[model samples]
Target: MKKTAYLCITALILSFTLKPSTVNAAASPVQETAKTSNHTAGIKQEQPGTLEEPAASEKPAPSEKPAASEEPAPSEEPAPSEEPAPSEEPAPSEEPAPSEEPAPSEEPAPSEEPTAEIPVQLLGANAAEKTVTLKWDNVNNAEEYVVFFLKNKTWIEISRTQETTGTFSLAGYGTKNSFKICSYNSEQRQTGESSEIKVLIPAKIKKLQTTAYSKTKVKLNWKAAKGADSYYIYGKQDGKKYKLIKTVKKTDARLNIKDKKNYRFKIVPLFKSTLGTIAGTASETSYKNTEFVSMGHQKYTYSEMCSDIQSLCKKYSEYVSYETIGYSEKGRKIYDVILGDKEADHTILVVSTLHAREYIATVVCMKQLEYYLLNYNKTVDGKKLSDIFSNCNVHYIMMANPDGVIISQTNKARWKGNANGVNLNRNFPYAFKRDGSPKDGSYSGKKAASESETQAIVSLTKKLNKTQTLAVVSYHAMGQIVFGDYGGKNQKLRSDITNMYKIARNTTGYSSAANYGGTSNGNYREYLTYKMKVPSVTIEVGSVSCPVPKYQYASAFNRNKLLILREAAWLENNF
Candidate 1:
């Protein structure tokens, strides 16, 4: 019985021991496989002998909870491994997304702050004194401010400040004025301009005088009154009153009279209140010259000028060829008089009556053509007139704005625009503007290159060769002046043309009187200088007036003839 009990005990001990060893071997392979899988799945595994295993006797008690227990053991091991990797990647990605989103949201906040502040205001305006006072409300968070003033339809920076209220006084503040303010932070970021404030100064007239020079002519002078943006000189010749001339932004004024007849002169001043206000006008004392006389030529209509030109072209059929360049808005033909030998290579372009009321200029051009054609064989200064024509091609576009001239002559005192209601003088393409006027005069057009007259002139000028077309001369009336382009990018041509103009002015007595030096805009002179690079001049024929009395035309012709002859001679010699 003792031996049997001892054997059974031994067998039991061996069975338990062997079963534990087999179970340990199976668990070891399972752990090895799991560790390999975990490494492939990007989870680090521990070494095979590092982990402790429970004894076989203890394993029986934990068998019911093996899944839960095994899961906790693996999770604890992986927790530390995954913590470093996942923390590195997730922390970087999450932090960047939030940071980027915050930056985008902050971008627009700066733009919105200043829009809520800064208001511009106009305090007072006086046209008689030619001064204005401007004030504005304070802006929030503004480190500095800038003020701008409008002079001659352009905004110029006037002052800058870090304060709230500002006062600005401007002398010679004329018929048009605009004001604006800009706020800035310490960082120098400009918030944008405040609302524009506009005001018009009042008009005042003073220091009007008249001087008689000859039995047939007189001169008028005056001081530019404060707040007087522009001055209009009116004259009465033989009891018929008319606007004789105008001067812009000038103080001193002088006018010459022709014809041995009585004449009366008066001055009118224009004033602007604010930036966008209409001008107000004031008239001064009237002075008279009892010795003024009239020129004897019969008053000719625009139609008459056209008819006579046609007749003269027909009369000289062999030498002159007449062709229509285009038609005006009113459908009147824009005639071109091709003078001189047709075979000549050198071309001279002469344009007149660009401004409708410039009747005397048109008359002068017509007479020039007639004199040149009739006396080409005649010699003056040892130069044959026929030789002049034979060498150069002369193109005379006599009546440029026939429609405008018709309006000016037909009892329409306020007529300064073409049939299309565009100021032909302001219709050119160079520096053209539509809204750059005093609501009274020289409105360019609805847009640049808008007017048909401007288009026609540009087309005609562009067609002429810069080398072949030696020069261009456009004639205006009133303010006896002969001015040409200078101080431009093209120095050689500008210098040459200025010299020619000086000669013309000295010979003709149409000297420069206004301080506002020549700046060509929508005018043919500008086109000739800047675009074509050709020498050009604008000859203001006669003193300030239109129709200039029929009796005065002879004296005007006498004074201007030598100058015109000099020009013709110069063209013939130079080109």
Candidate 2:
């Protein structure tokens, strides 16, 4: 019985071990479970290693059948192992499952966007009153804004602020009032502008009346306009169109006219607050014959005038040196008129119209030259004029800025630039640099002595070695003024020149106004006085309306001629 028991135990153990291996190898869990249950029920197994399979024809006894029923315990143990494998597989696969879900969520988050940026818009502008207002939508990411105003078609930065609501107001934005706006971030990158807004400023007119007592004196007066800072009174005579009679800061109700004649009058009110902005209309008024002399004659064309001068120099070639000093950009010859009986050791240089609009000086100088040449033998104040001309050589450079003159003649309204857009008067070798555009009246050349017109003059002045240039006179227009060396403290020729200037002022009935403010730099006079140490004066001729009207030529001549003649006489007496 012990031997049978031992054999049965071994068979039972083998059966148990083999059952698990078979279950693990099966492809389908259901089939594997069915097979395991059937095998457990059939085998009368003791333990895994002791179990054995039954023979084909063998049959189990009733007692062995009961032992086979215990197979359920082995089946239960395999069930626990299978459950753990399923649970372990899920744990490993969980990582990939979370990754798949997050991708979809990311797409929707990106689709939802932030706010967009806003654009600028301009509202209105009034140039007559010198005011402008602008409006625009608020921009995203904009911390502050800037407004730009347009004057004479130029965009000028006006103001900047941090207000979100888009309303901007500005004053002192002059003629051709236009506006635009821009938004900026902290980095200062400009966001685009709104649509351009444009406006027109209407002109205002102020009228006045004046009468001349005699052929040499005139009194003028006018009522003040609301926005008028100053008044410009103009007179007209037969042959000549209009002449600026006077400029008055104070509003005098009436003025006395010294010259007797038929006079047509007009007025232009100027805005003092805005230097270059706001112009008033010409007043409509006509008066009968007055004491003023009428200037009526066909003025010589540039070519004709130059030819006449050349001819005159040729006739008097024995007593003078005539040379083509320079050529304009348009190839017009510039002549230098030198007169002396002997080689000039001490020279007095006289130049006029370094700026084109200053034609009055050019005319005056030309007349003086003619007067000296024609009446060389005449005596004035018990002195022989010929002897004076013979002793000291006088060099007259007429129309130094020919190109500028041509430009001014062609474009009366905007006639400030040379052919190459340089202000010849400002183009000198000494400190000839400043910030001004071609549009401004004082545009210096790209470099010192850059323009051919200016270079030619400089070269000629430099080449005149025998002559020790004593003094220079340059002429300009508008204000009745005389300005001289302000560059240094030493006033060498101040008293003498001032005395001469006073005499000139007395003769012409013009006032003495000095350019006390040293704002205009790189001027020819400044260079002559400061750098070359030569005494120079810039004589402003006529009134506010430059190239004083043809009708007012007589009054201008009457007032200014004696003064210039005295200047020439003084030059002869002193130097």
Candidate 3:
């Protein structure tokens, strides 16, 4: 029995040993298969061989969990470098979709969409600078803008800029140009266009001049402007700004520059288009000629008086005649403005400005001569001036001592003598008196008829009295008085002189200081009354001192407008 038990124990030991071997042998394939599967599946199989069996034993259920956990490692490893390749593969596919979308939506939109018109505004044209300025609102998607002007029905590009405003030179462009604007994109494609605007480039007036037609009217003449349809005249008086005077279609225009002042005129060429009125460069400022006499605004100069004499002679050539009887000490002509028929039976002589400071009397005589000529056919009192002057001749020695008058006007001095320091009124030959040779104011000459002006007057008076019934009117200044006295004992001559003085006093409302029985001096009135035995009167004008103010001219003119005419009419009727 002990032997039997030993044998059985031995068998049990063999069984245990073989059983472990068999189990180990069976797990070996599974572990190998799992390792092979993990290797194929790209999983890590790094466990030891001894632990392989336990892992292999749980491989069916736990293999899934390990596979899930191991799968993250593989994914994370590739995410560093290789995963981007797969992502980029899909990204390329999506890129085509966006690219295709842009082709249809963005690209074609810029090309096919209706671009709004460019909003352009025309700034004024600078005539002096010869430039045209244009402005426009910014356009969307526009890279730049181009300025174009129409020339010969073709669009010509003038300028290209990115700014909203542009100034273009109109050097070669004409007075009128049609302009338009266009906006361009970065692709160099035109995006927006503007409506055409008509721009007027103002032209310059080349020349201008004014001719005085009357006291109130002036005629303007100018060279035609390059593109002007009309012209506008502007006038300005002393101490005033320019004003629009008139609009004329022709190059010549008649405007009222008015009387009593000097005027400057400007001529502006105008262009009228379908759009607006444009004023061009103005002509140089011009001045009117001496058609109208200066009415006491300033001292009337000798040169101006000489010009007026020539102008009046040309104006009244039919009824007026002039003679340069003699020259003054300064070589100025002594003018005799003769009116009426020279062969008339009666003659009346009106002499003025024998004293230098009494130059205002020359103006009065000229105005009277102009008035008579202007009213030559008009009826005054009961007869026409022509009819009255037909029988009685009237002569005016205007500006007898122009040289001395020039001296007084230039220096504003109270000079009342000839250039030789001779008072012409006291230098007459009829009633001789030896006054001292003072430089100014009432000085008789060295001898009676010593001065050329005195000799001329003396010779003229003697010649006139020989043929006609002569009357004399001597004009002086500073006192509103009339003097008619030469100690003449003849009844008819005294009566005539007194009647003439009465007429003048009544006409001018002046006080008379008649020295009907008084002695004579070397005065012009006395020379005519005492020696020539004709009716004579000395009329003194003005209430102020000599060289009266310009403002006093109106009163002087109104007071003397009819005096000479009335006297001439009386001589024609009675003489």
Model 1 / residue 487 / CA error / Å: 1.0
Candidate 3: deviation at residue 203, Å?
44
Worst 10 residues of 1 by lDDT: 286-295
How much is the lDDT of residue 535 in candidate 3? Answer: 89
Q: Per-residue lDDT tens digits of candidate 2, residues 95-191?
A: 5676576553332111122323344433443444444344567776666776667656456666777874344343433233455566766876555
Q: Flag regions of model 1 displaced more than 4 Å.
A: 1-298, 436-439, 513-519, 562-565
Model 2 lDDT, full chain set: 0.57
| lDDT score of residue 160 within candidate 2 | 79
lDDT of each: 0.61, 0.57, 0.72
What lDDT, from 0 to 1, does candidate 1 have?
0.61
Q: Roughly what TM-score does model 2 have, to 2 decimal places?
A: 0.45
Q: Between 1 and 2, whose lDDT is larger?
A: 1
State model 3's lDDT. 0.72
User: TM-score of model 1 relative to the true fold?
Assistant: 0.46
Give me the displacement of residue 503 in model 3, in angstroms.
Answer: 0.9
